[model samples]
Target: MQITGVWLPIITPFKDNKLDYQSYKRLIDHYTEKGISGFIPLGTTGECPVLSDYEFEEMIEKTMEYNKNRLPVYIGVGGNCTSQVIKKIKIAEYYEIKGILSVCPYYNRPNQEGIYQHFKSIAEETPLNIIMYNIPYRTGVNMENETIYRLSEINNIAGLKDCSGNIKQTAELLMNPPKDFSILTGEDLLFFLTLTMGGQGGILSSAHLKTEQFVEVYNKIKENDLEAALKLWKPLYDFIPLLFKEPNPAPVKYCLEKLSLIDSDEVRLPLTEISDQLKDKINSIILK
Candidate 1:
């Protein structure tokens, strides 16, 4: 299935350093009500790297269980280690998740050929659709459009979550991508621009707040109403940068906490809660 529309690469809400599954389920139910196209549960927004193996497994299972086919779920299965990512993919295969949002290898910063071989190996290993995630700042090595196009030639290497932050590259891929390949921008701020240029949709974190507005941005574009879409996107255009002003899910979780959507704005170590000043700013925007 072509992954389309606004998807939440959902934050794994924590309470006193615990998984807070009750809040997680509640969050999922709330998003489901908002009519999101799908759910991405263990992505960067989900804080995947810090989660324990048991927590990871439980997150996937509970996400699928709660979803119960209501919407497609793509579990994040990626790392610098190809073998380990494959192992994670195998584990994901055992469950009922729809696909895997595999990211480019970070830290190691492999060359383009290495990136190609890594995902090619993954495509060979799994029957599931693979959405290659290309976030250069975090991954260190950017996967050029040449490498991306090469990967798209593979049947199961379905599409991309383009976060290269390079408008030219994103536009190039959208211009002449492989048939049936979906390009879903991972940058929440670029959601409108990406869709305007033929992206499928977004895997957005800011979406967790004004859920339907994000969806309607895409819907308005699909209806060829740029005027209407931008009207909906104007406020988001101003607000999205704040969600990342304090390093990702922290600000996102904080907004959820203030909205009473989650129990606490707790996050794993290495990722702290938002600062008091930023919290006050977010409160002003979201509460208004």
Candidate 2:
């Protein structure tokens, strides 16, 4: 499948401090109606780390049920432990999740070679298409472009989620990538910027609000209407910094909640809910 266009790394909603399945399903329907390209569940915005294995499986199941496979579904399948990720990859294969968003192993801080071997081993275990997620700031190490190129040699290694926020890295990878290897940006703030450098598209958290606007920006640029596209995106530019004011999903969840798309303003532990102060700021900007 060509993994292109505007995708939302959706926030897993919580109600009464539990996985809010109904509310989350409502969101899936909501964004689909709003014209998002695809949905990415259990991603960073989904708070994958905080979710239990059962919750992870349930979230994927619910998301699939809601989307009805109208769009490609790529479930996040990365963790610090390779074996565990492989186990879930097997489960996803059985469950038939469309693709895998295997993030760079977090907290372990593996070296370039280790990261290469780590993904290589996991790819050997599953037959599904794999998209490498490289968020150096969060994973504590950047998956170098060269290492990424090397990994791309492995069959079924589909694409990448480049979140390093370094345009140079993106440019380099785009300059020399394996045949048909897609590159989707993780930074919503850099969505349009990344595309200018020849990125395929983005799996953005911010697309939760500005779905059509972002898509319009992408379409304009794709159709060679740079000026009109930039003008359309100008109003949404400030949203990037504002959405990330605290942490991911927190600010995004707050926005979805404010729009009454989800039932709860709640989040799991370790990632506290956005403060009223930030909420006011988000509201003010949202109003303006």
lDDT score, residue 14, model 2? 91
Report model 2's TM-score to 2 decimal places.
Answer: 0.96
Candidate 2 per-residue lDDT over residues 19-135, each given as its tens digit: 888888788887887666778888888888898888888888888888887777888889999998998888777665778898999898999999999999998988888989999
Candidate 1 shows a clash count of 0
Evaluated with TM-score, which candidate comes out highest?
1
All candidates: CA RMSD (Å): 0.9, 1.3
Off by over 4 Å in 1: none
lDDT of 1 by residue, 215-271 (tens): 888899999999999999999899999988988889988888878899998999898
Q: Could you tell me which residue pairs clash in candidate 1?
A: none
By summed lDDT, which 10 consecutive residues of candidate 1 come out lowest?
A: 279-288
